[model samples]
Target: MKFLEKKVKSMEPIFAKGGKLEKLHYVYDGLATFLFTPATTTKRGAHIRDGVDLKRTMFIVVMALVPALLFGMYNTGHWHMVAESGNMDLPYLNDFGAKLLYGLIKVLPMVVVSYAVGLGVEFIFCTIKGHPIHEGFLVSGMLIPLVMPVEVPLWMVAVATIFAVVIGKEVFGGTGMNILNVALTARAFLFFAYPTSMSGDKVWMGGQEADGFSGATFLGDAASLVSDSPTVDGATGLMDKFSAMDSFIGIIPGSIGETSVIACLIGAVILIATGVGSLRVMLSFALGGLGMGYLFNLIGPGLGNEYMQIPAYMHLLVGGFAFGAIFMATDPVTAAQTATGKIWYGVFGGMLAVMIRVLNPAYPEGVMLAILFMNVMAPLIDHYVVQVNINRRLKRLKTA
Candidate 1:
């Protein structure tokens, strides 16, 4: 037995001290590193180290977003079935299998295209730059499909993904360097490039062409009402014109994954529980949107006969507000890092989204633009936060 133990020990591969294996082990350690190492490092002063790498952080964000993806899949199928049968009366189709399969068929292509094109670009960039491939797109790719209307052309999706990856991400030197969220950039590109395809009510309901569709999203109806009011040949009140409850429950027309607020809330809970996202940001964003929406509702109705306002609740459930707040705005890499900074980011993003949604009659959804805007400002917010910390530290030292 002693001889056998000695042989086994001898056969073990010798590893150099603090060498490649050690570094590899550390690199792959995941969340354990964050707990063990200090977040800051100082050469001569207060040096701290942390094991948490960007990969681990990004992974957490992905985990939190899974619930949303799953729910979005189901909702996509549900809307398609509803549109196919011309049954706007029903909340959800009874046929689960068909609904699910249809949704998978419609959404999977976009998801695959986004991952394929985006990741391909990322890999090429990583190879050229001589750096490890960053997995930021793992979340962004999934997000792309979620924010898009179900009926968006597959070719458009592919083109938009390439555009976002090349222009929005790669041009800025790859992940962690881009100023805006890649997924939002793709959606924005599609929205501007193909306004008719992206915005109308018929777009969200798949198989619209076969069904002789005349669908109108909440925001689309609002815009139509505003644009073609009493002066136009035929016009109606936006609220009287559309089903508010349908919009609230996501039975109405809109983007594929963004229509369902219940699903979004469920996803938000999962994200919060996993510690993958900031509750502060989410809450603040919701509050900001609700506050603005209420203010708009109160003020718009009082403005005049033609300029009517949408309900407050409609703003929260309609378009991409919930989806963006729960997923896009909370992106740690492109969002404010500090707790205080998160509040400002969320509020600002929500306010901007609502402002554009209500104020600008041309574009309907503003969540994508709002998120992209905040992403650009995140670094500035973090810088100011860090400066505040520095000032506090200096004051403490002086007192000491």
Candidate 2:
């Protein structure tokens, strides 16, 4: 304790002494407080306190993402190997290490580039604005790569990062002030700017030309079903076209971390267990998506269309649904804070996502759009919820 005191005292002189330098240091410290609030003593009159801070909260989120990260690495290698050998039936245990390494090779660079470019811009903005750096990007940087295709060009990743950081984040006054999740903004940039690289049939599988690769993601199959041409031979069932089991296990091609429903569920459990995320929102989102999928299945025949009969479970496991529900839709800063508000927010996000995926033939994935849409509506959801509380309090006051 003495040693720690001495170290803090040693630094205090720099901040305590008044000058331009001291003012700058004070600003830095103040910014640090804003970015990472410390749990200090309260004045005791009617103060309420909690042990958690922004950094701790963000760290919990990062922990929740680990399962997906591990699964993404394994799946990336798994799909590449399958594409190379034309053997989708191989078990994970047969060549686990090699596949993991291959995926690590592809994914690590993207993570590094995202953090470097995104944080570099953030630091510059902080320095110029004479404010301390916000640490929110620490988590956003990790998220951007996980949602991207492994085959996305490094240069494209950099460009997208700049756009997301500058426009999505900085333009809105950084961090807590941003309207949309910055990571998703970066992805949205990539999706529109380079549609061919971001989407289509062949982009998800990663390997050299010698690998003889052709990728078919679950959403890709779903989108193909939207076409007048049959997704599979007329004799084959929809299940045969894309196995429900494969989607659950994440064997099919899609975004890097989004393929594995099992992995995403594991991550979601961790997030909820840690009290770092809202289970109500996640559950509501899944229920909402399943509801929409089931409704579509029932209505397809009545509408005289075979394409609408896609199963509900398929919506949960396919494309970015699992990934978004586990990560993007649960972003605390951009999502509803109240419990009741979260249910509405998540349900809206999930239902709209399924609607977009099933109704629109142009976009193959809807989770990104769904989450972005909810991020915009979260505040409105919270507003009504808060008003309900206010009205209840007024009613109690009158009764008393």
Cα-based TM-score, every candidate? 0.78, 0.85
lDDT of each: 0.71, 0.78
Give lDDT: candidate 2, residue 363.
Answer: 80
lDDT of 1 by residue, 1-400 (tens): 5675555344323322354443233223222223344343323211112444554555666666666566666777776766677665555757778777877888888889878877777666654565545557777777887788888888898899889888987788666677788888998898888988887667877776545655777777665565443332222366564555665566666676677777777778877886777899998888888788777656665444332366666678788898889888887667887889999889888888888887777776778888898999998988998899999999999999
- Looking at model 1, how many pairs of residues clash? 6
Of candidate 1, the 10-residue stretch with the lowest lDDT total is 40-49
lDDT of 2: 0.78
Name the lDDT value of residue 269 in candidate 1: 86
Task: Give stretches of model 1 more than 4 Å off.
Answer: 1-60, 210-212, 223-248, 305-308, 385-400
Q: Considering every candidate listed, which one attains the maximal TM-score? A: 2
lDDT of 2 by residue, 105-131 (tens): 999899999989987887678767866
What does the lDDT read for residue 25 in candidate 2? 59
